[model samples]
Target chain A: MEFILENILNLIGFIVGLTIGILSYIGFKNTGSPTLFRLGIAFLSISVGFFVVWAGYMAEDFVLQKGHIEKWVQTLGIGIQTIGYFFIAFSHSIKSFFPKSRYLRSVGMLPLFLVSAVHIEHILRSVSFILLAYGAIETILSYFEGKKKGTIFVALGLSFLAFGEFLGWYSFVFPESILYYVSISIKIAGLISLFIPISKIPLTKIKFDSEF
Target chain B: MSKINAEARMVTTYRPHMKIIGDILSTTRDDLHSDGGASVTYLIRKANVSHTRISKILSNLVSQGLLEQVNSEGTFRYKISSNGREFLVAYQTFSRFAENFGLVI
Candidate 1:
């Protein structure tokens, strides 16, 4: 029962992230907004990350009796998701920050490769939470600066995502607790809130029509 | 080098022509919604494009049913059609989405 619930929740996150990613990509194509492209990459990375973790668990439980590969897979997923969130947090500055040394950007993944030790999982989770928190704060600050409609929902969504990560980190420290389910639910709600504003974007209907 | 890049970026900020058309159409819609209609000169000023570009954009928008052409006192003006208004609404929604991510559209 627990396994089923976990897979189902991850599946939901994957679908939501995929949908938002595609929509933002379309927006990027239409508007040529660099930020939209970063947003697309962020959501798609998260979607892939969730899928990797889910698939890893399934493979470990069903096929590979390997003792600890599942944890490594989860770590890798978190690492990919962190990269996505970092791009989102620094959408505007990233281009200028690494104008000359493009390869240096891959250095961010160093922590993931080194995080195989059991105790290091908690540290990785904390780092992921911090990245998410930074992104949320940036969104909230943008909202305050613009005061645009629907931005509040975006800010709210990022807050919930950060909060959910915090809870997940706490649950990891004290296993077999209610925080696990609560964190999953909060993260799901965050994805939904982030989706609320973009749900009405007219991707298919944006093309110009023939006149009367 | 940075200065040159910044100058180039400023020039190409609204590039590839399509986005400029959308911006002008949407701006024209805003003018129509608030002031009932707008002239080519008004669109040029509001859309921050050159006279030739705004003229071309207005013609394209009219052909696409996004704007209705109006002629008064031998001068051509334009009003937002229903479709144009809908486009503006959708564009606003898209802009808001992008803005939430700190992207200026």
Candidate 2:
């Protein structure tokens, strides 16, 4: 029963991320905004990562008994997702300063290197939390500067995601607690928050001329 | 942070020409409409650009049938054409999409 619930949650997260990814991609294509393109890449990575995690979970529950491949699949998913969050943070807070710096972008992969450690999952979760927290802080700072409604939602969504990941990491210390369920629930809420704004983008009214 | 990962680096910061053209047209149309018609000086202020840049963009807009030049009360002013109005609406929709990502279009 719990396995089914986890898979359902992962599916929902994947769908939400995919929706956001497509919206950002369309925006990037229309406006040619590098920021939007980065955001699109981030969300797409998240979607793909979640899909891999879902597959890994299914395999773990149904198939192989503790194989190296299955474990690495889960680790890679988390690593990719962490890279996505890192891009979100960089795009939001530091892109303008180092717009096309190859050097700066390399910092995003530091978490991937840590996957060789014994507690790879915990390390990935902690790194993801940090990246997400950075993004949330940047969004909040932007909200304060502009006082826009959209900014507020983005900030709240990213913050919730960070908090959820933190709780997931905490669950490692207290395996018998309900923190796992709570973490999944909160992460679902975070995905919803991120999904809501982009959901209506496709229906946006435009009066384009035949020439355009 | 010291050693850059070769595969993770962003190579370019290029924005498509169409986007730039849309930005110029939308800014011009919105500025003129809001002001009921505006002088070059007003456009420069509204677009946050230099006078020369505004002049070049306005000429391009006028040539593209997106703007009309008017001589009113001994002052040259610019106004949005019907085509420009439609373009503005399309640009606005694009802006809203970008806004979802907390990006300024």
Candidate 3:
């Protein structure tokens, strides 16, 4: 248990990946969304996450490469993480952007485009995390507001996303911090949040008064 | 004492249920859902929704007497009236769907 908890990020990523698969099934079976875009996004995010884990967790910290090259690689890796998070959030909630999800086409790409010189060490990293978190929360809220709201599924997916980010980001910085394991704990919270709500939502059709 | 209705089936020369209605009152629906009621300030937050759309929902319900302004002050909150409640009961389709979903209505 201790060993598994310590590597919770990896575990949660695995679990979340599984949850997305299940959600896609349910969406198809129950809601009739018609395609597997949601599942594709979930799997893709998990892959990106695992890729980061490999680069950070398995790669030799001190390589034979030169200083300039190492910094370039590190920055490149962070860039990949940013792209991954953007799409994960996108896949989680397509409803919010309906009739103009086209706007999202540039949402993820723009921040990278306007990477101005006024920069700090991890400024992009920080800003990206904040936006991703905000986006995830927005998606969850939108799901809740839907007529056939499914708070549980959305919450579960968000848990994985938020924790995946926390773990991956924390590991990016700490690579050796004791708090490293907290990422998975965060992911666990996400899973439970989703699971609990899902079981009930299917039973309720958002009873609204004729007045509303 | 009063509530706005976003579901007016009739249109005032605006094609019914077009973006004219959807775009306008989507925000109203959001505000009402979040706060459990809506006001002018909430209407302002629904900046995307046209004043025309909000008027449609509110006025339709008012004409039906489902909503009425409760206060002399302009800062009145909209709420469901007794007629509205009766309408809501019918709208729920609870008796029909409840049986299908296996619930005791």
Query: Which prediction has the highest TM-score against the true structure?
Result: 2
TM-scores for every predicted model:
0.65, 0.72, 0.40
TM-score of 3: 0.40
Query: Tens digits of per-residue lDDT for model 3 on B1-105?
Result: 122233342322233232232222333333355444567455545543456666676776667665554443556655556555544433333222221211111
CAPRI quality level assigned to candidate 3 from its DockQ score: incorrect
TM-score (0 to 1) of chain B for each candidate: 0.69, 0.61, 0.44
Each prediction's whole-model lDDT (CA): 0.73, 0.73, 0.46
How many residue pairs clash in all the candidates, one count each?
0, 0, 5
Q: Candidate 1 lDDT, tens digit per residue, A1-212?
A: 44766677678768878988877776666555666788889889888888887888789778996743477788887777776667666764544434266466568556666765647657766676766777777767767767865677777887888898899889977788989888878987887887787775555556533320
lDDT of 3: 0.46
True contacts kept of 2: 0.35
State in Å the error of residue A38, model 1.
Answer: 0.9
RMSD of each: 7.5, 8.8, 15.4
Off by over 4 Å in 3: A1-6, A22-35, A51-84, A91-128, A143-153, A156-179, A191-212, B1-3, B8-105
Q: RMSD of candidate 2 to the true fold?
A: 8.8
lDDT of 1 at A209: 31
Clashing pairs in 1: none
Position A47, candidate 1: lDDT = 86
